[model samples]
Target: MARIELSGIQKRWGKVVGVRDVDIEIADEEFVVFLGPSGCGKTTTMRMIAGLEEPTEGEVIMDGEVMNDIDARDRDVAMVFQGYALYPNMTIYENIRFPLRMREVPKGEQDALVRRAAEMTELTDYLDRKPSALSGGQRQRAALARAIVRQPQVFLMDEPLSNLDAKLRQAMRVQIKHIQRQLKVTTVYVTHDQIEAMTLADRIVIMEGGAIQQIGTPDDIYNDPANTFVAGFIGSPPMNLVEGAIDAGTFTAQGIEVTGLPAALSGNVVLGFRPEDCTVGGNTPHLKGSVFGVEPTGDLTYLTIKVGGQQIEVKADRAFRAELDTEITVTFDPARICLFDAKSGERLR
Candidate 1:
């Protein structure tokens, strides 16, 4: 029963705010991810939950109890940090056993617990090695093994994969997911990587400038973003947005025109559509532009076109080829298109 609740949480350093009033309910055994760019206060929010940073207002509740004043060490939550945070001089065996020893698990039970965690992280063979002898991935695995030994009610991971290379990060992501599923511990992971959040989270909390922008599953965040910022930030190439105006159901801007807009929607607006939702070379296209560039990424060829003097990306078939600076027409699925108010960047519908 490790359900977590954050009610009206805020963090402020003097007059400058780090995080706004954040309210969320995390179900028992649920995996929730906090995702945002640097200085967006994602880390601060995690720290508040871990009892490391005191919230300026509101409560951090674990299960049904308020934990705002509980000492971090006594909170029974295990945190895995980005830097590994392993003891350099200690062997992997000693590192994994440290937590159990601190909590004074009986000496007779410590060896089996250490070996089990080591095996789970595939570090059993390297248990005798000091941190200096292990590669970055191995060291990180040792860090995770250490956390596994704690048997905490919740797992708080702060970009634990950020230190590894791309390939290692991918492998570790699989391992971490497997471990979390096996344990069924309520988890809160923080990262700037959208891919990580999309792959691992049961739900994602997107934050910007110290405030939450949206909270939803990966599909919801990708296919139904709440606003322009979310639409612009999630994808590898992101969604295409054009500044334009709609009047009498016709949306018009320089080098672009789209029709069939709702009669009631008339004003300055930002039209948006995903790169993959667009089909190139349509006769009655919604957008027309000259090809600006072409990126061939093996499976798919990404085409960049100049629309309304703005570069927009289109995901074309890998075999789909277009000459540079050549004209191309694009049509978007109406159900997949998005509209935003020009002033607030909020969704119009």
Candidate 2:
């Protein structure tokens, strides 16, 4: 029943704009992630939805009602911040129970609700310990338990896993996704980490410089990006982009030539392809270069090559072995390539 919609939302501080014309419809129980680099206004948008910050334009609608004027506490939204925010003096159980006490949910039912939340977060055994006695992961679980105790209509998590170590962050990502599914609460999570957005979201909203670049499922964003910014930002090692010209279906750049492209395009263009999509030592190589470096990460080897003074990264088998400065030939499917306007950076078909 909690369907949140932000219509033409804009946030401004005098001459500075924090967010501009953001419009998104989040379905009930949907997990939507706001993803971008720092200072991109992802957090400001979430704050507006939470009623912590007022928008200069547009409306915040929930269940078909305007919520821009509503107080934060009355919005029935639970926020878990980057900082665990657990009270130092309170035991984990008491911290989880604080939200229930504030809402004045019948004291008779508070214990059961707290216990249920604790069990769901796997913090049942640490109930009696204070925040100081818990590990970083456990403290975060305590914060989550507090939010769950309220049974809020929406969950706003702002970089909740940023403070944890890498391994713990991965574990918490699984737990958060599981808990969201279990509760069926419409959730909006904010993070700069693409891996987190790709793993946890049903849909991701990519933002930059107070504007949304694109919004789609992870697969859609990765496989068919809307623009060059998206093509470059969405993938690990990113897509290789080379400036070139297309003439009569032949794409030609310095030290590289690709043919059989769609006949509709002509003139200067930027060609893009994923690192993993390109192969080494193919019969008909699309690109030729010398191996500048090779990085092996146990599971895969990343090879960096210099092509016409531009660096292109390629993902190779983990056992791949090559000496520096060795000549290499790389080939990729022509159909897998992407084209963009060199000037505007907009995708061409």
Candidate 3:
């Protein structure tokens, strides 16, 4: 029943601003992710919500009440940090029980809650093992178990899977999402990894330079970026952007020309298209370019093509092969193309 809201939140450090005008409404049991690069204020916003950092302005509201002056412990929020932060000397069971003990839960009920959390995290068999004896993923699970045992109104996770290996990180991501759903707690997760944000979040809040760039569902953010920053930042190989001029319903760049654009737009504009949206060896080729590089990642091959002065990445079948310097014709759907104002970087339409 926790509906969290940050109204006009601002955080500043003297003359430096950590976050600026952050406003978000997190629905009950919604898994919202704060995503961006390092120093982008995602973590800073999370800290303010947790009451670890004071907001310079605005209110933190939960359900229907203002919680700006409430103590962190009294806010009923549980936080999982980037580091496992497990106790070196304590066994898994005892570590999970620590929060319950501090809150003075009945000793008899503590055992049941600890066991339930352990089972939820698949750590029931590792209860007696000390933190030193556990693997990185196991230790992180222990940390999760501790958080779950408290049954807090909100869950705040700060890059909980960053310490694990690539394979382990993927596994932990699934577990985290599953646990969040099962608990149905209002969760605020902070991470710089775009894939993590896409997979885990019910909605994503993309940030940059202490301000939010955009907020939307995974499909909304990927398929329809609001600006150039989001277009370049949201994709794996990123959207291909070219500086060009539109005249009489045609767009012409250095070595590429696209026709049938909106005739109303005549002047400098930036054109963008996703790597996956472009096609190679199509019936109606729009551009011809020499292959610069090909990267095969087992499932798909990313082909880099050089057209005039700009380079573009095109996703192709894994078995697709092409030699460097070979000329290839590329085509894409006109409906998939995006236009942006060259000066302001805003979407043109």
Candidate 4:
């Protein structure tokens, strides 16, 4: 029943603001992720939630109680850090059981609890091994196991998979999601990886420049970005943005032109569309360009076309191929295109 709410949260270091007016309501047992690039205040927001850093304004409420003054240890939250922060001197069993031991759970009860968490993490066999004896993934699992033993009301994980290799990271993501679902404790995960945010979050809080840009489910964030920054940051190849101006119903840029705009959108504007939304050809609305770069991902081929002076990326089928400097024609789905105010970066529609 750990429903968390961050109300008008802001953090500052004198004149340097770390986070600004961020607000989020996390439903009980829901998984939420704070996602952004480096120095974007994701971790700072998490730290404030954990009570490690004080918010210059607003409240950190859990289950309707304001936790602004509550010490971190007293907040009944478990945190898993990126570093794994395991006790090298202690055996896996001892490390996992440390929290229970600290809280003085009965000796008879400790064994079952410790063994259960270890078994849940698939570390039952390695309980006797010390931290150094385990691999990186195992160590991370050990850290997670330790958190599990706490049975805390909230779970705060800060880039728990960043330390692992790509394969291991994927595995850990599955493991983490599985554990979170099974436990059903309110969880907050912080990471810069958009894929992690997309695949793991029930709702994502996207931040930039110390302020929240948008918050929504993965599909919402992907399909309906709030602004140019979000559209540019959320995708694999990201959304292609070209600075242009809409005169009457027509949009004109260095290398692209689009008409049929909603209303009489005039003045400076930016156009955005996903690589996947644009096709190689065979559509009504088409733009011609030259192939500047082609990337084959085995599953799909990505073609970078120099549309006018702007480089527009178009996702093509795996069979698609084009040589550099070859003339190409790409069609954009007008329904999928986004328009933004060029000066403000806010979505126009």
Cα lDDT, all candidates: 0.92, 0.93, 0.92, 0.92
| Model number with the top lDDT | 2
Q: Model 1: runs farther than 4 Å from truth?
A: none
Give residue 98's lDDT in candidate 4 (0 to 100).
93
lDDT of 1 by residue, 1-349 (tens): 3989999999999999999999999999899999999999999999999999999998999989999999898888888998999998899999999999989999999999999999999998999999899999999999999988878988999999999999999999999999999989899999999999999999999999999999999999998899999999899889988889999878887777888877789889999889999898777888888999999999999999997668989999999888998988988887888888999999988
Residue 163 lDDT in candidate 1:
93
Q: All candidates' TM-scores?
A: 0.98, 0.97, 0.96, 0.97
Task: List per-candidate RMSD values in Å.
Answer: 1.1, 1.2, 1.4, 1.2
Q: What lDDT does model 3 reach?
A: 0.92
Error of 3 at 61 (Å): 0.9
- Give the clashing pairs for model 4: 255-308
Better of 1 and 3 by TM-score: 1
Candidate 2: residue 111 lDDT (0-100): 98
Please, what are the lDDT tens digits per residue for candidate 2 over residues 52-154? 9999999999999999999997898998989989989999999999989988999999999999999999999999999999999999999999998878999
- Candidate 3 residue spans exceeding 4 A from truth: none
Worst 10 residues of 2 by lDDT: 221-230
Q: What is the lDDT of residue 10 in candidate 3?
A: 94
